[model samples]
Target chain A: MAEVKKMATRDAYGQALAELGEEHENLVVFEADLAAATKTGVFRKKFPERHFECGIAEGNMMAVAAGASTMGLVPFASSFAMFAAGRAFEQVRNSIGYPHMNVKIGATHGGISVGEDGASHQCCEDFALMRSIPGMVVLCPSDAVEARAAVRAAYEYVGPVYLRFGRLAIPVFHDEGMSFEIGKGETLAEGDDVAIIATGLMVYEALQAAEQLKAGGINARVINMCTIKPLDTELVLKAARECGKIVTAEEHSIIGGLGEAVCAAVAESGIPCKVKRVGVNDEFGHSGPAVPLLKQFGLSAENIAEKAKVLVK
Target chain B: MTYEENMDLQRKAVKVRMGIIEGTHAAKAGHPGGSLSAADMLTYLYFKELNVDPKDPKNPDRDRFVLSKGHTAPGLYAALALRGFFSWEDLKTLRQIGSHLQGHPNMNLTPGVDMSTGSLGQGVSAAAGMALAAKHMGNECRVYTLLGDGEIEEGQVWEAFMLAANYKLDNFVAIIDKNGLQIDGPTAEVMDSGDIAAKLRAFGFEVEEINGHDFDAIEAAFNKAKETKGKPFGIVMHTVKGLGVSYMENSVDWHGKAPNDAEYETAMNELNAKLAKLEAM
Candidate 1:
């Protein structure tokens, strides 16, 4: 493989927001004191008039975004995943979700990738919390290119959406030719032995897992399931039919994350395929380096390959 | 602004209180005490303060009102209906299975509701957001929000107040219905807010204390709010828990209970007598 440029998904989010500010006149950005970290500072620097610094109040920011949405403004509210999804869930649910406001929640530093922040800052359950809200679109982009596209797509689509971004610099595997669509899954490769369905940074790991599986004479398919809410059930069912075994990967918890979503879809289809979930198993993450945490929580490419081997067997 | 106008507003407030009784009585479950206490304020806002239209309830440039104390949906619904946003008949259907007038104000379901708010302390932030958006658009639109005395116990309320002040939301006004009573007991006993005016002033608001039920004071406070500049406005209005009904006033039991048939009739009669006396005057 050639040397791929690496960038944080949040960096892409910031660049995309700056670009969006030039396009959409009504596009407003809000931050809760973490604009520099969440990368909304890029938008703030260019469009200070449209950028609102809401201070260190996530609950207030969520409701403020919802209020702005009522007036036909596309408000992108950004904060760490812990504060945006966990601390201010009720505000997001009641203010934005219930009213179906056109506010996009840019939740940065999602999952265990928020390294050295300890368990308190590392939010691995945001996927579960956001997915529980009715009429909330949940999108987790795989790489920087997809993350940038996801930001534009969320602004174009009118409604409440939670776009999760990560802090660690990951490989930019996706090309600009791949069009981003909400609620649609992309099949990266085709195989027959086992299917690896993934989201966020885990999609790259799933692709790597496919390469590893190929060395062991196992043909593993790679599918990037970006939209978690209106999940691509068609691709999931097709994979279950073609490949008799399935493995799901994410940087989140096994409960209520992509793993459970895939399992539920397979079970609903009554497809008798053995499903394995590769994620943080019903536990909290600790303070560590991002790569080591991925390895510790069985979220790495090798770990995904190991899970795929069992499912294939 | 005048004696005759105040009397007219007083009569409208009486009608608003009667609507509150009618709605809660029909629903058989609601927070009547808060609703009754907030009736006069809602009447003043809808009839006099807000720059809105019944024909175009979703007007973008019009001033916005958010019921931060949203359990008082009856009070808000009554005011909206009387303002010709809907029929009085719709207010009676509050909390019913298919009623648009939900137990809490839903902005999508209810016309003229700028923001749907039920969870305490969340609506103020929403109001601040509306005010911010108006400022961003360079429109002269204003935003008003009403909060309960006891509902200030939520930490989010102070957070919202701080933001409104920090952003210098001069177009925003927050009115705290300081009825001094909650569901458990008196607000001072339940959870003493400790000099709400001082606290709000510290939070950078132009604070005013007034009698919430008195039309003159309510009018003065709103007028001052509109004229104020460089800071958010706060009006801590002193009011009775249940303002009109003789038996329910200052009583905690009426905080979240519907009046029985006899109680409802008695309350309506008292309001009717007051209305008749005002008209004769």
Candidate 2:
């Protein structure tokens, strides 16, 4: 097997922003003193004039981005997910979301992948919080290519967007030429018995789980759900109709993240599908190494494969 | 400013105050005290200061006014209505279902409103963002925001002030309506913002203090603000809560309530008398 390249989605976000800056003159970046960590510093290095350092004030940065959006500028306000979506949730809701402003929030280090930051820094509730806001587009990219594509898609789409990126360097699975669209789910593998729907860092894990399930004589369908809000109900319903037994995976809380969204879609369609959610089981994550913590929290391909195996049996 | 100019602004301010009373009374539940206190400055900005066209409200080069103290939407709505952004008759429908005049300033619904603000201490940051945008785009447009004295205690307001100063947004102006009273009681008792002008100066602003109702003083402060360079401008307008109405003045009870029919009648009578006096002058 060829050695897979590994890259953090936050790095892809920064590189995508710098490339977008060259294409869109009105593309400006705002960071709440996390330019280096959130990877907006890459864009700052390239387009110093368009970059705004808003100190450690995420609320003010969100409002500033909202204001800049009103003046025909596409402002990407970057910060850690804990601060961007958790601390400044009201600012994001009232200042940007309420007005339906064209502000893209680049929230990095989402979920327990933020190693050693402890429960305080790991933001597993960003998708739920951002999803609650009306007219907010919530996106979580699976790999580096998808992250870059999601950033460009956010810039092209009008209104507010919340793009969650992970801190850990994960496998870059998707090809650079792959098409990415907001509200569209990409199916990586075909199956008949069970379907594994996943988002963010867990998409790669779902693919690995699919291979494991294949060896165990259970053909598992793998779907990468990037857009959590305005969820691809069509694809979700189709998966439910075709594969009655479904397992949803994410590096987030199972309560209101991709799993709940998929469950809601399936339930609303009145489809009789048994769904299992493989995610952080409604608990805060303590300080630990990223891979070990993820495995311990049951956010691994083994867990997903186990869940799928149960449903298949 | 000339006596005639001051009288003209006074007349406009009285009309705006009447509009505030009308809107709040019609809603039966709205913040009238802050709206009345902010009426004079709202009038001055709409009538004399802002380089905005009522016919072309969305013009990119136009000066932007954000009611950072957005609970005083009645004052802003009245000023915008009188300036021909909408019908003054529509002011009666303030906060009603299907009304464009929301309880707070919503930029999308109201024509002259530049930013949506209701939650305290957030609007100033938006104004700062607008100022930064203007500086970046080289649009040569000024951004103005109004803040309540009590609103500054939110901590986010100071963050915005820091941003405005750090960016050297000379084209930005932050006006605080120091009405001395919030919903609780006097601002001194309810988290006093001690010496706002001095604080603004410390935050890298060219500070000016003035009687908010005094048109000449308001004019002079704005002129000074335009003249000052390399820093943002802050105007601490000392104002009385419910300035035009007789009974509501200095009363914290009137902070967020509508007047009864009899009290409304008395308020309208006093304002009408002031209008009659201004018209005669």
Candidate 1, A1-313: lDDT as tens digits: 6798999999999999999999999999999999899999999999999999988989989999899888778999999999999999999999999999999999999989898998899899999999999999999999999999999999999899999999999999988857999999999989989999999999999999999999999999999999999889999999999997999999999999899999999998998888999988999989999998888888899999998888777
lDDT of 2 by residue, B75-150 (tens): 8988999999999999999999999989898888989889999999999999999999999999999999999999
Candidate that would win on lDDT: 2
The window of 10 residues in a row where model 2 chain A has the poorest summed lDDT is A173-182
**What is each model's TM-score for chain A?**
0.99, 0.99
Per-model i-RMS: 0.7, 0.6
Candidate 1 wrongly placed segments (more than 4 Å): none
Where is model 2 more than 4 Å wrong at Cα? Answer: none
Write candidate 1's Cα lDDT for B168-187 as tens digits.
Answer: 99999999999999888888
Residue-level lDDT for A199 in candidate 1: 97
Q: Clashes in each model (backbone N, CA, C under 3 Å)?
A: 0, 0
lDDT at position A228, candidate 2: 95
Candidate 1's TM-score on the B chain:
0.98
TM-score of chain A of 1: 0.99
- The TM-score between candidate 2 and the true structure equals 0.99
